[model samples]
Target chain A: MRLVRQLFTVTGLILLSAGYAHADDIKLVNQAFKEVAVVNAKGEKEFKLVEPGTVVPKDEILYITTFANTGDQPATDIVITNPLPNNSRYKAGSAFGAGTEISYSVDGGKSYGTPETLKVSGSAGQTRAAGPDDYTHIRWVYTGELAPGAESTVTFRTIIK
Target chain B: MAGRGYKQILSRLAAVLLLGYMDSSFALGTAANTVINNTAVVDYQVAGVPNAVNASVAFTIEELLDVNVVSLDAANVSVVSPSSGRQLTFLLTNTGNGSEQFLLSVDTALAGDNFDPVPASARIWIDANGDNTLDTLNDILYNGTNGPVLDGSTPGNDAVAVFVLADIPAGRTAGELANVSLIATSVIADAAGEVNNVGAEITAGGDGGVDANIGVSGAQSSAIGTFEVVNSGVSIAKSVLVFDTQGGQDPHPGAVLRYTLQVTVSGASSIDNLVITDSVPANTTYVANSIVLDGVSQTDAGDAPGVDFSDFNISNANTVTVDLSQGGNITVVPPASFTIGFEVTID
Candidate 1:
C-alpha cells in the first residue's frame, strides 16, 4: 500500500510540473541611484539621476524595481515587497507605482495598510500612527493583470541616515 | 479546498501575530565600511501556479573625515610677563563616521598682538587624566610624532581634551594681548591640502578597510585662544596705626590715625609713573605737616627743584599724594619698595 501511494505522489508531482512548466514568467531588477544638479546650455540648473559612487548621510537615493512577464501567459495577483535598507529612512510621499495599490508595513512584511491606517508602538509603549520613518517595508499589489512581455516599474526614495 | 483554505488562513493569522523588533538609530549615521544590502521580492500567479523571484543590490558606506577644534576657555587667559608653563584648554573632536588619528600643531606668531610667545616654547599635551586641566606630571605631552587617535563610532570616545602651553615673552606691557591657535588635521595618508573638500575620496585610506572622504570640515580644524598680559606682580600693602589721648589705641575724638601705604614692584621690567593717592577718612581732619615719604618729612606745599614728591591737599581736598616716579623722572625697578605715611585727626 505504501509503495502504491508513493508511486501516485510521484505521478501527481510530474503532472503538476508539466502543467505549469513556465512558472518562471516574471523577471525583476533592482537598482539604486542618486540625484545631481547640472547646468544646461541655457544656464538653467536641472536635477538628474546618476549612479551613486559615494553616498553619505542625508543623501537621497532613488530605488527602482522593474518587472516583466517573460512567459506566454499573463501573470495575475502580482505583488512586490521591499524592506527599507538599513541605515536609511523612507522619504515621505516618494513611492510611485501606476496601476497598483501601494501599502506599507510597520511590522516588517507580515501585514500591510495605508499610511493613515498603519500604527506603530512608540518608545514609550504607546500606539501611534505610522509615519514614513516608521515604515519598515513597502508593498505594491498590481490590480491589472500583466500580459505576456509586458513590463512596468515601481520606484521609491530613501535618505541615508 | 476547505482544508487548504483553512491552512492558508492559519498561516496568515500566525504571521499577523508575529512581532518585529525595530533597530536603534546610529548617532554618527552608518559606520564606515558598512555594507547596506537591499532586496525586493516579487510574487505572482501564472495559470494558477505560484512563483517568486527576488533581486538584491548593495553598497559600502565610506568614511567621513571630519574634525572639530574649539577653545574651551571661557575668556582671554590672563598671564604675567616672563611667565612659563601657561596653558590654554581646548577640545578636539572627531565628528566623523570612522576612527581617525589627528596631527596637532600650535601657532603663536599670530597677527594683531603686542608680542609673540617665546619661540619654541609652544607645546601641546593631552589631558590623560581626564581632569580638564594641564598637569605637567600626569598629562601626556604631545610630541610632533605622537598624535591622538579618536574613535568616532561613539560619542563617549570621539572627543579629547587638549592643552596648549606657551611661555609669555618679557617686556610685554599690561593690557597687551597675544593670540595662539591649536590646529588638528586628519592623519590619513594623502589627506593634506584637502580642507573643505566635502566629497573628495581617498581610496582604502580609512580604518576598517573603508574609503575616506573629506567632510565639510575639510579633515582639519583650528581654534584660537588669547593670552592677555596683566601687571599682577605689582602689589600694595596698607596698614593703619591709631594713637588716642594718653597713647591708647582707641578711636576717640582728637585721636591721630597714621596710615601707611607700602608699594612693592616685582617682575622683569620697571614700572613708570608709579603714583600713590589716598583720601582722608570720613569724619576726620587732615593734619598739616604730617606727610612723610620713606620716613622723611614732606612739606604741606608741593615742593619742586630736587625736593620731595609728597604733598598734602594738592590734587583733591583732604587727599595726600605721593609720586614714587618723582614726576616721571624715574622708573621704579623690581625688587624695590617705598613707604608713604600720612596722619589724619578724628573730628
Candidate 2:
C-alpha cells in the first residue's frame, strides 16, 4: 500500500511537470522567425558570331556571347559547347567566361578528344590535347552556381580552315 | 465506509473532468495562435556607373550582377492586403548557412525615379492552425506612404522588417541563395523582390543603388562589339539640281538651287552627340537659305555616324531648304515644297 501511494505521488508529479500553463492564467507572448533571402534567377543570355567575309592568314576570327541571369533564383547546370564550322578551325588555348570545357576533333566534330588524339598532346599524355593552333570547337560549363541577377561573358578565336 | 468511498470517487471524477476541460481549452487557444514561418522578401544590387572602367561607352544596365546567395529574409513580405485584413503566413528560411536578421523594408523614393518599386502598403499574415486561414497581423509600410519614392531629391527608404530564424533546411549549405517576393501595386515598379535585375544589388543597408539621367538608367551589364573600318573614297555621282522658291522656279540667276546634306555613322563604335561641317562645292553657287539632316533639324550638330561619313548639305538656296539623308532631315514639307520649286541656270 505504501508503494502504491509512492507510485501515485510520482504519477502526480510527472503530470504536474508535463503539463504546461495552468488555468486562470493569461499568457501573452510574441516570437519572430527570419527567412533568408533567395535569388535564383540568371537573366536572359545571348550569343552571336558575325562572319566577316574575308580569309586572311593568321587573322583571328572571333566569336562572342553575352550572358545574363534573369530569374531571381540562381542557375546551375551550365553547359557551353560549340562545333567549329566547316569553313573554320579552332585556334588553340582560347576559352573564357563562367565555366567551360574545350574539345577538338580531327574527324570534323564527328568525335572529340583532347589534343593528343590529333597528334597534339597536353601534360597528360594520350589525351587529345589542343593549343592555340589546333582548335576546332569550344565549350565550357560553370562549376559553381550563378547567383540571382548575375551575368558573365565568353569569347574565343579561330582561323578560316 | 461505503458512503465515504462513493463520495470520494465522485469528487475525484469531478476534478478529473474539470482538469480535462481546462486542458482542452488551453490547447485550443495555443493552437489558435497564428505566426508565419515562411517569408520570401529579398533585395539585391548592381554596381553603379562609377564602378565601370570604361567611360566613353554610354552606360546602360543590360543585366543584374548577382551575389552568391546565403539566405532569404521574407519576414516583411506578405500576401495579405492591409485593408482586406487577410492573413499572411510567412515562412522564413535559410538557403545558406550564413543566417542573419537582415532588415526588410519597402521604400518608394526609388519609385519616384526608377519607374518601379515594391508595393505601397501590405500587412503580415497569421496561420491559425485548424483554421487553415490566413489572419492579418501587421501592415508594413516605409515612411507613411505606399510609394517607393521619398521625395524628388532624397533616396527612398525601403520597407523593412527583421526576422530571426534558426535553420533553413536540414544541412548547412554555405552558398545557398534565398529570395523574398511579394505582390506589388501597379503604381510601384517592382511587383516582386527585384524581379528584373535592372541594376539590382544587395548591401548591408538596402539602398537599391541606381541613378538615372533622362530616362535611361545604367544596367548591371552591357555589351561591346568591334568592326573594322575600310574608308572608301568619297562618293561622286551626277548631281540632280532643282530650283524652287515658294512655288517660284527660276534657274536663270534668280532661281534658288536646292542641295542635299548627307552624313552617316560607319566606323564600328556607335557615336551620338556629333558635329560635322561640309563646305559648299566650288561648282555650286548660292546666296542664302536653310539646311537640315534626316528629318531632324540641325543648326550645326554632329557630323559623324558609325562606320562612315553620311554628312552632306545644300545651303545658299534663296527660299528652298536642303536636308541630310539617312544621314538625317532633307525632306521639304508641303509649305516648303511649294517653296522648293525653282529652275537653275546651267553654268
Candidate 3:
C-alpha cells in the first residue's frame, strides 16, 4: 500500500510539471534606503555613504532591495517591483541588478515598457519620450533559477526634491 | 524837615529799585509770551503810626511763532507703490513759548515729484508711548481728527512724532520722488474753527488759545516730508544643482538634478502681484511629487487653503507657478527674498 502511494505521488508530480509548473517556494525580500553624499576630502569631491533619513535638498539616495530564497527548494522566474519614493526623481540609467531583465512603469505600474518605448506628456501637451524623472516604478525579472539559500540585491538612485 | 527827610528816603529807595528792575527786564526779554512784574512799598518810622504806600510794575512778553520740522527716516522705510504700510516719519517741535497743538496734513498731489498719481488717503501717526521708535505694535495711529499736542512746559524738549501713511499708486518708477507736504498748523485759542490753515499761514495771537491755526494767533509751521518710491523691483534667478556617479554639477544621462529659483526684492520698497513660472527642461524628467518651497516639502496635487501642494501646479510643461502675493500674503517687501526647488533626472 505504501509503494502504491509513492507511485501515485510521483505520477502527480510529473503531471504537474507537464502542465503549469510553479515555484516550490517564494523568495523573501528586504528593502532599505541610503543617501549619496559628495564629501570634500583633501580638496576633492568624493562620493560618500550617508545613512538614510538624513537626505537634504539636491542630495541623492539609493534604494536597495535584497531577496533571499530561504525555502528548501529553488525559486524560478522571480520578479521584483518597487515604486519610486515621493519627493524624489529616478536617476537616469541608475537601476542595477545582475542577471536580471529590467523594465519601468510610468502609469502607476499598470503597464511597463523599455526606456525607448515609454513616453510621457510634455508641458506642451504633446507626448514625448519618457525621461528618467518620469519613471514611477521599476521591475527586475530574474532569468536564472534562484537556488535555495541564494541571495541577490537590486539598487537604484534618486535625487531628493 | 520831617517831610523833606521822608521824601529823600523814598526817592533814594525808589531809584535803587528802578535800576535793578531795568537790568532784569532787559535780560528776561529773550522769551516771547512771557510776563514779568515788580511791586514796591514805602513806610516812614517818624510817624510810628505806620503810614504805608505800594507800587507795582508789570510787563507782557511778546509772542513769536517758529515751526521747524525734520525728517525722521531712521527706520529706513521702503516705499513701494500701491502699498499703504509705507511709513514717512517726521519730528515736529513747538519751538515757541507756551504749550500748543498742531494740525497735520499731507499733499501727495504736489508738482516736481516723480509719482504719476500721488499717494491716496494719507493719514498720520504719533509715538504716543514716547519710545522714540515707530512700531505699529507700540505706536499710536493719529488720523488727524485731532491735531497733535506739543508740550510748552519745556520749550524744544517736546518733539511730536508725525508719521504719514499713504497708498503709493501703482506703476510709479524707482527713484521717483513723491513730494508730500506735511502742513503743521499751530492750534490757536479762539480760532474760527479747527484750523487746517491750508490757504493762509497762522500767526500767534497776542492772547492764547488752542486751535489748528498757526501764526500770530498761535503760529502755524509748515514742513515738507518726501516719500520716494524706491524702484528696487523683484528679481528671479535660476540655477541647476546636479548629482551623478561621474560627479560634478553637469548633468549626465540618468543623473538627478535640483532646479533652484531664488526671488529677491531689493531696494527700499515692497512689491505685489509676484508670480513665478518655470517649465521642466528638455531631455529631463521631473520627479513626480518633487516640489519644495522654502525648506518645506509640498504636495504635487492638492487644493489651496494653507501650505499645501496646491500652491504649485504641474500642468502643461510640468510647469510650476508660484504666487507669493497670495491674497496679500508674501508681499515682496524690500530687502526680502525667497527660494523654491524641484527635482528632475537627465534622460
Candidate 4:
C-alpha cells in the first residue's frame, strides 16, 4: 500500500510540473522625493479708523479683512462690498477697489436708499428709520478669480445703532 | 542547473542586452525596467567636480575645463617676529594650479619688518598678454633697477617679496604688515564679449609649501636684518674699541680714545653671542671696567673670576668682546635690544 501511495504522489508531481511552469523573482525597492515643505510670507498696510479724533460710542466698530487661500488652487475675482448701515457714515477712499454702486441708509439695514447727494425720485415717506444702533455688515463682490497659490482680502468700518 | 523560470528569464535578459546594445531608446531612465520592486537604479558620474578644491589641472581637456582655484588671499597669511624688535617677514605665494595673477601687499602697523606701520604700494606687473607666460612688461624695473621685484608666471615659480621696515620709536610695538601689496590681475576672455579683468590677493610666507602660496615645486625666500650703535661722543661714534693708539685721541692725562659697539637684529634672523676679539697694539693699554646688558653689569674678566667663560672675553692683554645674544622666542632677536659698552685708558 505504501509503494502504491508513493507512486501516485510521484505521478501527481509530474502532473503539477506539466500544468504551470513559470515564476518571477520578486524584489523589494525604495523610492525618493525631489522636494517638500514650501513656505512663504506677505505684507499688509495698517488699517486707519475714519474717526481718529472723537471717542466712538460702544456700538461703533472698525476692522479690516485679511483673506488667505491656503488651498492648492487660487481664487480670482473675489469681491467684498458693504453699504453704510443706519447711523453709520461711509468713509471716502476706504474701499479697496472701484465699486459700481454707492448708496446709504438712515433707517437700519432694511430699506434701500441712495446717498443724500443723490436726489430722491419721489417725496420721502414711510421708509424704515436708520440709526447708529443698526447692524452694519458690508458686502464685497468680485469679478475676477484667484489663481492657485495666491490670496487677497478687503475691509471697512461700521457703527451699530 | 537552471531554475524553473530560467528559460523565460534568460530569453528576456538576452532581449534586454541586445536592446541595450542596439538602441539608444533604452539607454537611460526607468523605461526598460519600470517595475523592479519599486526601485530603479539612477547612476551618473559626478561632473562639475574637477575644478573643486585640492584638484589640479592636467594637460588634458578635462583638466583644463576643470581647473581649480587657489586663493592665497592675505586672509590667512601672517609674519612671525623672533623678538619685538627683531626684524620679521611675511611671504604669500600662488604656487599655481595654473597661471596665477595676484598682488602681495602689507599694512605694516605692528611687528612688520620695521617697528613703523609701512604700506608703500600695491603696484605689480603681470604678463597682461600672457606673453611667454609671465605678464612681464619690458618697462617693469624693480626697485628702480632691472627685472621684477617679485615676478613669476611659470606655474610652479616663486618670488621673494621685500618690505622695508620703519624706525621703531621707543616704547612702541612692531609696526604692522602693509604698504606692501602684491596683486596679480589676469586679463581673461570669458564667455562674455569683452575681456574680464580679475585679480587675486597674494600673501607673504617665510617658508615653501602649499599655504606658503609658493607652488607645487616650492622654493623658500628670506629677509635680512641690521642694527647699529652710535656714541654721541664724536662725529662717528668713537670705536672706543682700542686696537691701536697711534691715531687714537687722548682725553686729559694719558687717556686713550675708547668706544662702544652694539649689535642687534632689527630684522630677519639673529646672531649668537658672538665674541669679537681685537688685539691691543704694542702702544695700547687696558682699563678695568664692566660691560652692562639689560641694566646689569658683569666683569668681562675678574682677576680671579671663578667660573670661566674667561675665554668668552679677554681684556688688557688682548681685548675680546663676547656678544652672547639670543632672540625672542626663536633665538637671536630684536626689541630685546642689546648694546655693549667698554672704557679704555691709554698710555
Q: Model 1, residue B88: what's the lDDT?
A: 88
lDDT of 2 by residue, A1-161 (tens): 35644554455445446642111111111111111123345653322222332122222344444344454445455444455443334545444443545455554345666555555555656654355455545545556655555554444444432
Supply DockQ values for each candidate. 0.28, 0.01, 0.00, 0.01
Off by over 4 Å in 4: A1-161, B1-181, B184-258, B264-269, B281-284, B302-317, B325-331, B334-337
lDDT digits (tens) for residues B1-347 of candidate 2:
12443244334433433343221111001010111121111111111100001001011111111111111322322111111221223222211111112222322223112112123333322222213233234433323243221111111211122221111222222222222232222112232244334333333212132221111121111111111112222221223465654466555544456555333332212333333334554454433324443443333223345422222243322322322232453332111111111123334
Which candidate number has the best TM-score? 1
DockQ of 3: 0.00
lDDT for each candidate structure? 0.81, 0.30, 0.58, 0.30
Off by over 4 Å in 1: A1-21, A38-44, B1-26, B189-196, B233-347
All candidates: TM-score: 0.69, 0.19, 0.38, 0.26
lDDT of 1 by residue, B1-347 (tens): 12443244334323322332133354666677777789998988877666677899887777888889999999888888879978889999987888888999998888988888875988899987778888889988998767888877676788899999899978988888989999999988335556667678887877677778898788989999998887765688999999998799998999999998888886545688888889889999989988888889988788475788877788556788888888888888775888888899999
> In candidate 2, residue B284 scores what lDDT?
48
On the 0 to 100 scale, the lDDT of residue B157 in model 1 is 80
Could you tell me the TM-score of candidate 2?
Answer: 0.19
Worst 10 residues of 4 chain B by lDDT: B57-66
Tell how far residue A70 is off in model 3, in angstroms: 99
